[model samples]
Target: MKKDYYEVLGVGRSATKDEIKKAYRKLAVQFHPDKNPDNKDAEEHFKEVNEAYEALSNDDKRRRYDQFGHAGVGSSAASGSGGQYGGASDFSDIFSAVNDMFGGGRSRAGGGAPFGFEEFFGGGGGARKGRASAGIQGTDLKIRLKLTLEEIAKGVDKTLKIKKQVACKECNGSGSKSGATESCKTCNGTGEVRQAQKTMFGQFVNIAACPTCGGEGRIIKDRCTSCYGEGIKLGEVTVKVTVPAGVQDGNYLTLRGQGNTGPRGGAAGDLIVVLEEIPHDLFSRNGDDVVYTLAVSFPDLVLGTKVDVPTLDGAVKLTIPPSTQPETMLRIPGYGIGHLRGSSRGDQYVKVNVYVPKDLSHQDKELLKELKKSQGISPDAHNDPHAKSFFEKARDIFS
Candidate 1:
């Protein structure tokens, strides 16, 4: 059974575009397959999130879904089962949109076969229609890489070890021992067989890939020993990825031709690297800007001091001006994260948090009493119109 789109995303029916995007991003990061490897439940949740976002993110689909529910949205992305919809064409449109969003589109290098779900389900065929009978492209793979604030602030290189299909070294992906094969009698080297049936409407012809020889159009006398007859073998492969600086969490990088090798020496798929930013101990990210809270004592605020502030680059000296009020926000220009695609750097904001001593020493108490006397602030100064209010007095402490 299909779940409601809003329910799947944990959003309200009245959610706006931004809210919908934020909710989807949060869920995508949490339930992403890379983050929860070997967990089927997480994978299911990831699909559910994708299905919900695909429906609600679009204005037309959202309107249809709001009125007619899942049936209104046509095919759910999670199931990819071309159920009853407005028409047969809707299935392709829905899945195509989803595939593009999930990094399953055509190869980034251009003129390559698709790794979309349509191809996997015998719809798009990955390769061009005429060439699909000759070559089958490999499946795309996704993995998550966690980066610290320091690494993200500056671009870093990463090495990943993954087990994926590669062309068998022995047979050179020909699937035959001596690289020799004979045409199949079933399809007569056409790679497809035709079946004719009589229906109520008229005669119907069904064209399907030949089962014998598995659509290769030829039979191998001696199959490859390394990869059996599949022409591919699973092996551990090392892939190097260059992560650009300022890449936000949940954003992904695409490495062309680094995924599983295609069957029968077809084009290899892409490797999608989704980045996860590890939380920083002292800094919080807001876009490219970094937020930091600096605690200062009353004397430090009054006397001013040079303090060390932590930034992605390193610790730097920040000057606190004399008589600086609490909650003063100081901007350190160009100390935050760099632009992902540009050279501009964001600023770091230091918010001052005043700290008060709860337990005063005996001499401190006496000094405070003397200071109050000198300032002419009586114990009953609350009734004085010129006196500071409770809020004003506590501003530094609460700010």
Candidate 2:
């Protein structure tokens, strides 16, 4: 028996269109065949998710399914046939949903397949049935790039070396030694084969790529010796990337057409660079601002002093007022990381820490004993009326 469409997608019956789409996107990515290679259960779950989405994504089909379940919509509404599972246009909708998730909306010129569909499906299946002769797009490549806090503060340019598939130079990417090819006998040069299956509902016709020619419509009579007829080989490429300021960890940048070159004179893919921020030894970042702890001696805090603090650029003088409390934060404007989009920069916050001597010498203790006799040196909250409370100081630090 067919499962309930809402149950298959794990959505409520009254779920909105966006909610349904969100659920479908999550399930599709989880059970996609490419992500779960050689797993039969995952493949079945993928098909089920696609079928459920096909029926639910459309208003009329969803209404019919809601009223009479699977019988009302039938396989025709989901697959464009009364007996089959899915068709070319049905998969196109699935590809559209996936493309929207990845922030890619560009399609090939002259209405070819969408940008990521070919990469995910290998330019085969129903999406590229009629355009089998058209060259396939290469798969996208991803690499993690480590960036230092200093580099992120000031945007830096990086050159990366990538190893990927490049077109074979021997055959000039034709995959034929003599540059000669013949029509495929299985598909009769049409690049596709159709099969009719008899089911309980009716006859369903399925059209797919030709296996003999691998959907290229033509077969190479003489295979290339270097690439073994695949027209691509493992090679290295150098790519330059510019990273903007204030880009956080897990942020990524995409470079178009910088990835692996497709086989048989096909278009190239994209390169995805994911940013990873290296931990700083003396500083920690909080949004655009950076925080550093500055330790000062007890004598320095009692009597105002000037000390140098470390910054990304260099050392800068910081002022400590007389009787400044511990855990007080001092702000240095325009000294932190630069804003991502604007010229303005965040402030650098210095957290004050009192440095206490672990072991005092005999002379140091005698001097401290004489200073302890002074009434002003005793701990008294009434001594300073302007002194801020702990709660007030904490609020100032965070606010």
Candidate 3:
């Protein structure tokens, strides 16, 4: 059974066109596919909303529906009036309603009214000729660059060899050995072709690049022998890149006009370098901070000792204070990674791990027994804070 159109939009039959449009806008926005993705109920409700609007929004349709119900509106309710109601019509109408709500102006290049969904979701196809051009832009390229912690701490320069399209040297990007050409007859030098297509919405004109001259608007009379009339060839080029300090993994550096050259004499694109961090053996990165674990003998921890600690710059002497805890962390300022585009440097954190002897010799055991007696050591000494345990403190490092 068909539900009442007035009930669907939650408006009276006496509602004006502006009221109908306003009600439909609210319901359409609430159930739009972009807002309620993967929801079947919202999709169906959205269809119902559009169908109700299509009928009530039109005076003739609304009069026929009011007088004789679905039968009076004709086969529109059954075949969905070729997208006048629901299903595929739902998707297109949803975008139409959205465009109206946002006050979007339709494209005037085509003779027929614009299908909002086709223009909104589907990227501009060959239909719109006003924005068409003869010169094609080159495609952008991406490359992965692996950097070490040291390189990230200190900005480094790298030379990259890339394979890209370069303008042919033989004809100087003209694609002709004799530099002779004639205007294309197929597109009439417009560099595009327009074709008319009939749809449910009416006649629509589609524009595409000219097939004969490949959108160049001219035909090559004499082909270049080196590039075979392509006007471009694959070649290797070296690019010098300066990676900034403290750049994290997955960050990108863009080099404009450094990618493949366009066909003929078109403009070149960009080359993007994505950064990847390589792990270090002794140090791990935490934001701008460097984390390193330093192992010291039990005697060194009790009596205090000076040891060399590894840093982003170099190894430096770090003092372990007397009676220091096994899990104690020491911070050295201005010894870690440098700030990107800034003058400040980060600090390095060193964690201490005390080492205990696993085996004891006879003389060592005799001295330990005398010391234990003098110190009044008990069997439960393992529970002491200074005693070695299997538990280890975990550190979270970004790298």
* Candidate whose lDDT is highest: 2
TM-score of each: 0.61, 0.64, 0.64
Report the lDDT of model 2 for residue 194. Answer: 69
- Over 79-138, each residue of candidate 3 has an lDDT whose tens digit, in order, gives 574254445535555546655753453453233545543353333344324433334556
**What is the Å distance of residue 352 in model 3 from its true position?**
0.5
lDDT of 3 at 39: 85
- Considering only N, C-alpha and C atoms within 3 Å, which residue pairs clash in candidate 2? none
TM-score of 3: 0.64
lDDT of 1 by residue, 231-333 (tens): 7789889988898889988999988888888776667889888999999999999888899999998778878999999887889999999988888999999
**Candidate 3 least-lDDT 10 residues:** 390-399
What lDDT does the true structure give each of the candidates? Answer: 0.75, 0.79, 0.77
Instruction: Write one digit per residue (lDDT tens) for candidate 2, span 1-399.
Output: 777889989999999999999999999889876677667788677778878888899999889998998888875754563123433234445555666653443243114444443243333343344452345677899999999999999889999998988989998877888878888899998777766644332333545577777667778878999999878889998889999999999999999988788777667789999999999998899999999999999999999799999988889999999998999999989888989999888888999999988999999999999999989888666456555476567788999
Which residue runs does candidate 3 get wrong by more than 4 Å? 1-134, 357-371, 374-399
Compared with the true structure, the alpha-carbon lDDT of candidate 3 equals 0.77
